[model samples]
Target: MNPILQTTINKAKTIPISEERKAILQEFIQYIQQKVDAGKTVNLNFICTHNSRRSQFSQIWAQTAADLNGIEAACFSGGVEVTEFNERAVNSIKRAGFRVTKNGLENPKYFIFHSDDSEPIVAFSKIFDDSANAPTGFAAIMTCSHADENCPFIPGAEARIPVRYEDPKAFDGTPEESEKYDERSLQIASEMFYVFSKIKK
Candidate 1:
């Protein structure tokens, strides 16, 4: 792992998670555990209204956490509609010690790297069922309330789990814009680390 990212993960493990939240996260843990015990690959697809913020953060952090814990899991993120991956979220990830390469202009593809040894996570905005993502046999993790409430059904998902988070997009253009974005990113990172920490590798 990248040294800075490893440090971030270490700090994330110390962030407090409420008992209520832990209970909800347990459901996610159980899903991964069952797959591992069955000798099956774990696939997670994070969903939100736009694949721009919360969902993107969840996908990156979850994949990094799984890798740190020696778990074999594939992580992806999508949304109900397509929009460019918000630049603010991309900046937040870079600040968290990732090496990011942006490709193209409109709806640019982001190659996010947490470690030199690993392939970069190619991130962009697209619908949940985009051809790039697993069509079936993956858990659809809802990362925002709007998508959770409105997206009643996610076809081909073996499990649909709601792990909602507040939208930092609300803070966009505010004086606390950067701060809020960083805060949300760390919160997601902490929770993701917590989830993988509970699984027995």
Candidate 2:
């Protein structure tokens, strides 16, 4: 891993997750463990109303946690509608210790790297069932309540799990924007670390 990201992961592991939150995360952890024991590939698709903020963070952090824990898992993110991945969210992730490279103008593709040894995660904003995503045998992790409540069904998803997070979009142009974005990113990273840490080898 990139030294900075390794440091970020170390810090994330130390964050205190409340009991209530842990209980909620336990369900997802159990799902992952069951799938692994059954020898099935574990794919997680984090979905939100827009592939901008919360879902993006979830996908990246989950993948990072999986890599760190030696879990065979693929992570992806999508939205109900197609829009460019918000730049603010991208910047927030950079603040969390990723080195990012960008391509394209409209709906730009972001190649995020945590380590030189691994392939970069290719990210862009798109609808949940975009061609880049797995067609089946993946869990649809709802990262925003709006997407979860609005999209009643996700075809090809083995599981539709709602793991909602508050949108930092509310602070978009405010003075608290950077602070809130970093806070949200850390919260997701911490939960992902906790979830993967519970997996039995």
Candidate 3:
């Protein structure tokens, strides 16, 4: 491992991540760094079936992580089709401590909830209506298998990276649901913080 990576890795293990998960988190940081350091603005589109739970988590944390680590990047989300951003996901991120604001409530354009200091993470049902609203030739990030295979080609994406995460939605409606949701959200936040902490600039 790079000496700097080792120094920052200590931050990740402090979170309750398994060996495999910790590795995934590290690799993701490295991937984003490699992409962004090329003097390019990285547009990461984290996708799920509904553009709801897992993708939403990735969108906020990725932007927050980029800001905390001083990396310039943009994060977005999409589904194979149109659907609402899940409320439970929004509530989970809020409980995990994101700055959430409903900009266009009820027929509004989007719901922007992000750290005020960070580049706002944009969450919508599909790709942004305007190309200028996003990075041209963005990176297609598949957060779920359904998206990974179903959508083989994301228009204008320079690359596609699959960074799948555990779906706490599986626990929905069960006794342990809320606990799992919050637990998973914390886990995502901690790992993201660890990643941003790794960047040199």
Candidate 4:
């Protein structure tokens, strides 16, 4: 396993993490680990209204969870509108102990923190980068409702899954906002682990 992934797994140990979350993580780890063990490359595109909070969290944690489980898969994201990636989301990932780096020619330098030998989350434009964002066959995972309804056809998705998440942005500026965001992040992380855990070998 990669050192960064080990770091993430260690961090995954903190915060009195729940049994449900652990089960989900373990399941996800088991499933995706099988895929990687078979030498397959899984491509996931996590989407939302903006390429900001909820989708970002899903992308990060899903990829991290995959890595922690020893899966060799990549993650990407996009938005209905070109909203900037949330700084808070990035900060949360960093605080969770993953190393982040920037890479982009024009769009937001898709920040990536390597946890495995998988490709980083590349900054891909919704209007362009069809190859990277959509590819020939990929999963269009709707992490929010707006992206799902607005983008009825994702041009190249082999499958579309609604993994909706509560918008932490809703709690913005409130006293519980930070807690809410962290909670939201944890929830997505937990679920991604669960889904990947069931991936067919």
Q: Give stretches of model 1 more than 4 Å off.
A: none
Candidate RMSDs in order: 0.9, 1.0, 6.0, 4.8
Candidate 3, residue 112: the lDDT equals: 48
The global C-alpha lDDT for each of the candidates, from Candidate 1 onward, is 0.92, 0.90, 0.66, 0.66
Give the lowest summed-lDDT range of ten residues in model 4: 122-131
Error of 4 at 23 (Å): 15
Model 4 ranges off by over 4 Å: 1-40, 102-107, 114-119, 123-131
Ten residues in sequence with the least summed lDDT for candidate 2: 1-10
Cand. 1 TM to true fold: 0.98
lDDT of 4 by residue, 1-201 (tens): 456446545544454646754653553345345546767677678888777888778877777666656666777777777756666676666656566776654456665655445566554335312445646455777888888888888867666777677798888789987778777876676577666656554
Off by over 4 Å in 3: 1-13, 22-27, 103-119, 127-135
**lDDT per residue, candidate 1, 1-201, as tens digits?**
667877777777889999999998999999999998988889999999989999999999999889878999999999999998999999999888888999999999999988988878889999999998999999999999999999999999999999999999999999999999999999999999999988886
Estimate the TM-score of every prediction: 0.98, 0.97, 0.77, 0.73
Better-scoring candidate (TM-score), 2 or 4:
2
Query: Order of all candidates by lDDT, from best down to worst?
Result: 1, 2, 4, 3
